[model samples]
Target: MLGDGSLGNVGSPPRVGCVAGVFDLFHVGHVDVLERARRHSDRLVVAVLSDEWAMDAWGARPFVPLLERAQIVEHLRCVDEVVAVDDVRPEWLTGVLGVQTVFAASATDGVLGVDELDGIPPGLITVLPAGRGSRSPILRAAIDQRQSRSSVA
Candidate 1:
């Protein structure tokens, strides 16, 4: 929302895009999706999920706290705005933030569930292909392995 270099013309809403994630590890895969989201719209808002919500949805707490996680995403060069949210509903951005597009990691496995995205305007969503080794599950495994080896020593 800062620069005027990319804002849409007057009388039309700005071309805003939104992406949400737990961002526990803040790995390159997170970067990949945000980069893609940036491409889909003029302004990109990255919403980092709160620790409580992450635990409720995924059954495990994020290794990183919500404020720290949001700070991590805020530093990304591709992101225009960053918010920490307890809810991951796409409508929050579309209905309140004037976001015109929402970038998801995939049709089946993005930050949002299919039900949350229901009723979204057609063609307003972009699903990026996820690459291996960048997902939280993979990073979490690595952390688990390192901790296990250290504990055994």
Candidate 2:
């Protein structure tokens, strides 16, 4: 996602916090993560990765386009800012946004190490509880089940 603050109204910054993701398919699990991020700070910045960035990082294009995905996040009341983050190293993003805290799902792996975490400059790292059925395998199973039913119909 590009780091341009375009989601919420410009105010006094408001102890900004953040959560970043590919946000493919705009699932309920994504909403839960954003909502949880909002609770930790007055202003929540949801970083939606760009298509090029997603392909580079994840080896595939995202299910949703960057503009549409960003709009979804921008419209949410819980989100105070929406930015495009394209960093290979995300810890730098926390420092750029002046975030007070950074939230991620408990299921997340490969997050910044202690040294990388310290480089955040201002944000405190926090992990939220992993929501039920939020994992890729579980979500894929649910989607497959729905698709199978539709095919039968």
Report the number of the highest-TM-score candidate.
1
lDDT of 1 by residue, 6-64 (tens): 66666666688888778777777677777766766778898787888778877888888
Clashes per candidate (backbone, < 3 Å): 0, 5
Candidate 1 residue pairs that clash: none
Candidate 2 achieves a global lDDT of 0.64
Query: Could you tell me every candidate's TM-score relative to the true structure?
Result: 0.76, 0.65
lDDT of 1: 0.72
After the best TM-score superposition of candidate 2, give how far the Cα of residue 33 lies from its true spot, in angstroms: 1.2
RMSD to native, candidate 2: 7.6
lDDT, residue 136, candidate 1: 61
Which residue pairs clash in candidate 2? 1-49, 1-84, 1-85, 2-84, 2-85
> Candidate 2, TM-score vs. the true structure?
0.65
Report the C-alpha lDDT of model 2 over 37-96, residue by residue, as the tens digit.
676677777767678876876676766788888887789877878887664244555557
Model 1 segments beyond 4 Å from truth?
Answer: 1-5, 8-11, 107-110, 113-123, 131-136, 145-153
